[model samples]
Target: MANKVYNFSAGPSVLPEQALKEASAACIDFENSGISILSMSHRSKPIENMFAQTEQYLRELMGIPEDYDIVFLGGGCSLLFCMLPMNFLDQNATADYALTGVWANKAYKEAKQFGNALAACDTKSETYSRIDKNLKLSDNATYLHVTANNTIYGTEWHNFPKPKSGFLMADVSSDFLARKINVSDFGVVYGGAQKNISCAGVTVTIIKKGLLGKVNRTIPTMLNFQTHIDAANMFNTPPVFAVYVMNRTLKWLKDFGGVDAIEKVNRSKAALLYSALDNSKVFVGTAAKEDRSIMNVPFVFNKDVVAADKADDLAKEFLEFAKARGLQQLKGHRSVGGFRASIYNAMPVEGVQALVDCLGDFEKKVLG
Candidate 1:
């Protein structure tokens, strides 16, 4: 279809059409109960069964252990940043953070209000181009925090870090389920679902059972992990619509053979697009080669390195060209002026190939 443009949106990125189709059906009549999933009581049996099955599917897909409790909560990863310290950090100790990008830096700063917060390592000097695996932590550090992927900088931690003495926590907002990861590597793994899971209403938190009830501070009921855990993510009215859609997406993931299969497709998509970027005379990747993200490829049209002209004329031309031909949202973040193509789990290889073909066409038109 001429209207079927490739979506390169960073997040709330792309979802499987199958999931959307199924969710549309559920919205009208879920499980043939004649009760719309949107209107169903949170305590209703069907919703409970659906929610429980969704969690189970996630567990099987990720190989998450029994000791880890997965809760679909609200407020996204931003709220988790504050709640993590409130529920875990002790008054006498500091929490260490690897400051790789904006979100990580925000998390470390937020933790400062709860207790001693230390930036163990930061790539700010390097323009957040790469991850620093080697880190320095306080002897009494309560936990080590890191962001698994930098959406804005287009860098990723291919090698996850392990804390030497304390709990390891990750903010995996951008790349959840895009690859295979050992759940046991971190004491807590959490992210906002908008990027790859589903729409923006839910935040999934996977926490080791032992990590809760350790902080000395008196935490608010809403901010406590124990509250959500005890209530099974129903301490309050859950985001019914968002969760229903997410459950549907999880089913699609399972049908597509889960994370392993999706990761393979993701790798192939990224490789195809990146191969095009690396070979183009006008486009230049912004991230360090080894740390480049497989999910989000950020690049710039280098007028200086390729052709002498107005600084951003070629970039503008290519954006218009791609948009007219069914390739869309290839623009980068406002802070970083360039192009970023996010090929998440659901973005098909055809979408990526379309963008790659656009790049090739643009290069041929401009250079010759």
Candidate 2:
């Protein structure tokens, strides 16, 4: 068993050790200001500098275009769900949504309150095991919304869809900053900072300048993307400590060779676990092979090896077994009755190897 604990939580998940160390220090005296980041004013210079540097690092890492504007909001993607429809979906114009997973459904349902938002492709009936490539998006629709990664179901959209006439928008909460993305591919790319970027309380949004002013409805000042853009994401009081931590995380990522390098590492880690699952006699992955997520890997004890009625017991046993070896939060979502290994950016190859070894040991014991 490893001495260091490996966290597999989906969000509010693992962050780089360097970021955590620096953030801990900042809690007492941020940038020699003699005040904690939690106590610093949002309008202060240090906070402003932190915000700018975070955005700049994000821009460089993701190759975000100059035409796009970045902002950090108080609410996570849940808030962006309503904001998206209010700012873009006009009363006359319709928007299309890709029903990918739980979050996607929630976002789609939220959009229904603002305007006529239809599902371009729905995989709910199929248990969201794969990304539907053949999307029936309407050419005249205002925008097409897609969730880049399905956290619960362990599926990811490897290839993004293109809208004929309207722009594309994406909620990339679970997979944010985990890989390289083309900024020009979407009108908006937004997600919570907790997953692959920073801690909770702040959501990062990158919006294309051309998408605004298209909606005729009156959006509240805070809900309006333009408001934050004008204020540089300091319209009211921003989440100070979260942004400070995010800045540190971004700096760590930059020093670690940016998104491209981390992406290679991410892919390697995912491959190791998935390969183990593919060859395992005791475990079987839930998500479709083609659409498997690199960030989250959900699998269960093989029903063929263990009876369905006893699967839960076996899962519990395995979770306890893994936890004893310093693995934490390997439990799957309550809705998904198995185990999920969330190998986010901070999750190293060694951690994945530990999990793979644990899985193998458990498999042997189960078989024996």
What are the Cα lDDT values of the candidates? 0.86, 0.90
Root-mean-square deviation per candidate: 1.5, 1.1
Question: Candidate 1, residues 235-287: lDDT per residue as tens digits?
Answer: 88988778887888888999999998998998888889888988988888888
TM-score of each: 0.96, 0.98
lDDT comparing candidate 2 with the true structure: 0.90
Q: RMSD of model 1, in Å?
A: 1.5
Report residue 250 deviation for candidate 1 (angstroms). Answer: 1.2
Q: What TM-score would candidate 1 get against the native?
A: 0.96
**Residue 258 of candidate 2: its Cα lDDT?**
89
